[model samples]
Target: MTDLQIRATAAPAAPGTTARPGLLLLLVLTGQFMALLDVSIVNVAVPTIRTDLHASGAALQLVIAGYTIAYAVLLISGARLGARFGYSRLFQYGLVGFTAASLACGLAPNTGSLIGFRLLQGVGAALMVPQVMSLIQRTYTGAARARALGLYSAVIAGGMAIGQVLGGLLVSADLFGAGWRPVFLVNVPIGLALLAFSRRLLPVLPGDSSRRFDLVGLVVLAVALGLLVVPLVLGHELGWPVWAWVALAGSAAMFGLFGVVERRIAARGGQPLIPGRVLRAPGLVPAAGAIFLIMAGFAGFMFAFALHQQAGLGHSALRAGLLSGPVAVGFGLSSLHWQRLPQRLHLPLPMLALAVVAPAYLVFGVILRGGAEIGFGAEAVLTTAGLAAGCAYSPLFARALSRVDPADAADGSGVVVTVIQVGQVVGVALLGTVFLGEVSFPAPARTSGHALLVTSAAIALAFAAAAAFALRTRRAAG
Candidate 1:
């Protein structure tokens, strides 16, 4: 065997009884939901946060982007850490940190403190989120694994929509007159409960002593991602500053350096953070590309639409959040049920669904351009788009990971999850720019309508590109 082979043995389950798959899944998935939910939940509460903390635009942007960037930059390292330490051990550590960060965010006295806490929250999520997928990949096999992935995908898609809805509710409810703090504080109790149950439910696995940490790879990758993501996120907000441009330009070179360093590590018979074999797995690259494109479009749509509803249409926070209900329901239903279809249809489904998504966005744009409120027509269109998105997204995770070797599960999960977080950051940065540039705060309805239409066109183009990649994925798989 090559020295690069990935191998590890899992210790027995907790003291008395074996971990029940269903309960175990619930425990881990809830952690996944919280981690992912924090990404978008803050969107609905941003205005309130701005008012409450007297935050500047840059600070506000950091509050949202910092978490995602930190989460993305450290994912591969976190996965490697999970393998070096135990998955269960890292998960508990991450949960404790995330929950404590949540409390600090809720109580933060200023924008600076909030941004710092948010970064810590992202770090916690980075450590926790990868373990969820690694756990799923390591624990289950056959149909059970498939079902677990389906639920996992549902949580993945549902979290963004649910965050908006739940955030709006929490903020609007103004529980105990705490205003925007509830959104962060709500995680406190749930995190504590999950930590309690996790001790008993998760399997205690042994660390892989054979594998060594690639500190150079981790630092290079983190710097590369920071250069890429920071500029993409902060560039427009800073009016395309020279540093942003320079950072964007430098990121390409840094990524090239990262590749060279990884290859050197691999050539020396060391395990690089991201194994070359994982990236070369058949169908994995195209599937990841499709995932990145679709997620970018989906996240962009959510961010842009939230702005349109509140800033453009003058909707209440609750109503704006409630507007996303159809999407959440549709995504949840489609993601959970896609596997029921016949075997032959599975490979082509993503391409077909993505094709549907492109036109769905255009149609949704047309409806809004007509100056219609989010009536039944708009709701139907949104739900259809959500259903298509679910169909496109759920299967791709399985498709990409299926091509990966079982031993590379943690590395593969890290790569895919990192792609997802980066996609969201890019989507918000680019598409949000399109929306913001076209419409300003408290603008005329007509202006807002036009801005949304333009933004939707951009989103449709992204989905169209995703469809092309999905087609490639189908061909590659076939």
Candidate 2:
């Protein structure tokens, strides 16, 4: 190991370190909570942003897609960068960047500027998020690690719920007459507070001084994803021009080139951006497929539901946020039981849960069609969907990483996260477009809600097919 690696690996804990781990975990979790919360918190604010910026529907889509694309593309590079420059240093820098970017986003006077700022904010988030898992792995061991993972998982689920609630409150509060700007600005105080705490709380991890930056791999991957995703997101809105198809075709060729380059790098004894062996793992294919399908369904539902509740139901942002709470609660409740289910069941619990979740969405579709008023009944169905999603997600992730070597953990995580992010883009593009097209012919007031319901049903059917395939593959392998 190089001197930096030695320093990173051999960094000493503070004297009598009992309280420090707990304190560090808390600080880390706080930052992570903010990062995860921002993902969905903005959903409820989409309409507000649209109106405020005088944005087209396509512009609004770019606001969300821009962040996710940047986030996904940067994740692997961020991990490698942290390993070279030091995790603590990168994390602190990321925190500052994220806070600054949030401010920029809040203060952006136009749609274009807002989208640019959001992309920058995503880069900061990508830098910070990978460190959370890496730090956990490095800091905690054995039962402590397990407990930390459990806590981390719980916090993640809780944060998703809190985002909606907080988004609602912030948008409705219109603090300082900033309107939706407060939603972005809210991160500043929390981020600054975390920065203060991190100085004392985070243990310095050693860096690999000899680690060479994979500039070629990074450029190739970024270009490939950008070519692929940017077009998908923009193409539908632009009426699918021939250039979109050309871009899509170019993306496939870029991906192929990326693979070949990575292989060459690995053969030459360098660390490639992504290790091909990890991707070739036996169970990874199905796991990835399942992840893609599940996230596609989930993202599409959220996008459509946000529009339905606000535009269709004539509800305020706060009411839309409140209506979404049951989904969060359901996810939390189901997640708590994840560890216990596999112990009692002979089958892969994730596959089983996914199987159940498809039906839950179908039932939700029925509920929507039945015209149940938005009260307890709507809440119950949403909660049920959340529970089913929670149960399905935890196990799917566990299965994906079950056989991965520790050395490749970060890479594996990055790959899965990137795939999910891409899935989200596709989901919004395809499902959202379908819904929009369907509703175009309908009367103004009645269209959005009905379109949303149909989109939900479509997603449910896709999830069912995916779940069935996963279960069958597992059985065949056995």
Candidate 3:
């Protein structure tokens, strides 16, 4: 065995350690929940923040998109950092940074300060979020790992759901007459509590110190991702300017350059940000494609649906949030219980779940096209989509990493996490643009209906494409 492997084997829980596995799981998952909650929590507060700060439209967009942009760009590097330092150590550092940044965001005096603090928040999230998956991969085994992943999936869905609900609630309540500040400030107490418990509960797993940080690869990949994601995030809001199109074109070239650099690094017998061996793992590609598709479809649906209700139909933020509860309920239910299905059906289940998702979206599109109100049929369709999404999310995640060696866990985690963030950006940018373009500010109910119909069709197409990837994943697994 290599010297690094020797140290890794010795780095797990010491013989006399008292950390309970269950508490440790809770500790790490809570950290994940906090990271994800921040992403969506700010959405409902954007209007409030703009009004309170007298911010410009561009600044408001930055406040909304800055966190995501930084998080997407830095995630892989953060994963590599975990592999260089210890996972537990990096998680702690990230948590401290994230908590502090959240406080700064809540207390910002103006839009510029808030934007800077939001980017810092993303930096902390990039450092912290990737480690959640790496820790789960390294610490758990077999069925326990599967269950942990199930809970992780649930937290993901739950975080998105709760962020909307809680943000609306906090803003509406205006507690202490604080309109939008509580949304960011809420994390402070939760983060502080998690910090106090993390060091004691998390296992001290050592990373491979021999693997050098690939500085050149990091720079190339960061630029590539920045070019790709920033435009996708801000393009629609900025009315698809020439700079956005140019950035999109530039991203493709940068990605090509990044691939060349990774190959050269491998040729020289040095570590790349993502190892070539990990990229070649069976099932990883198809699983990743499916994951991208699933998230894209779901995120687009969520984005367009929110606008359809609030901007198009003149619904209140709180009511819109409540209306979307069925999706979260369905997702949380299926994600936690998918394991109980017959063992013989396991391999084909993700594809079947995705099959269900495609039709549900198609039906939803039809309903929206018909100018259907937010009634029983519409809610049912949303729930069905959520259930199928929940089913596909966990299994595809497992399939993607199942063949990855423990030594490559951080690399694998980084890739998956980055794909998710990118997928959400693409979904919102593409479908959101379509929706927004079809309607005007103060859009009539009829105009909103047409816009939603078009967005739903696009989202349905995305799900259909995802189902195809899921099929390929099934074949890959077989």
Top candidate (lDDT): 1
Estimate the Cα RMSD of every predicted model relative to the unseen true structure: 4.0, 4.9, 4.2
Error of model 2, residue 225, in angstroms? 1.3
Q: Write the per-residue lDDT of candidate 3 for residues 1-478, one digit (tens) a residue.
A: 2111222342333322334878888988999888887777776676678679997655765676678778877888899998788888889989999999999999999999999999999899899988887787677654555566678767865676566667777777788998899999998999999999986887878767986999999899889877876777677677789999899899999999999999999999998988988888777888889888877777667767776777667676677777778887787787777767786777778878877888787777677764557889988988898888888876777677666666676788688878877777677666766877787657677778888888877887787787777777664445
Write the residue-wise lDDT of candidate 1 on 120-148 in tens digits: 99999999988887787667665566666
Clashes of each: 0, 1, 0
RMSD of 3: 4.2
Return the lDDT, model 2, position 148: 66
Model 1, residue 345: C-alpha shift (Å): 2.3
Q: What overall lDDT, based on C-alpha atoms, would model 2 receive against the true structure? A: 0.74
lDDT of 2 at 388: 75
Local distance difference test values of all predictions, in order: 0.83, 0.74, 0.77
Which candidate gets the maximum TM-score versus the true structure?
1
Q: What is the lDDT of residue 209 in candidate 1?
A: 70
lDDT of 2 at 32: 78
TM-score against truth, every candidate = 0.94, 0.91, 0.91
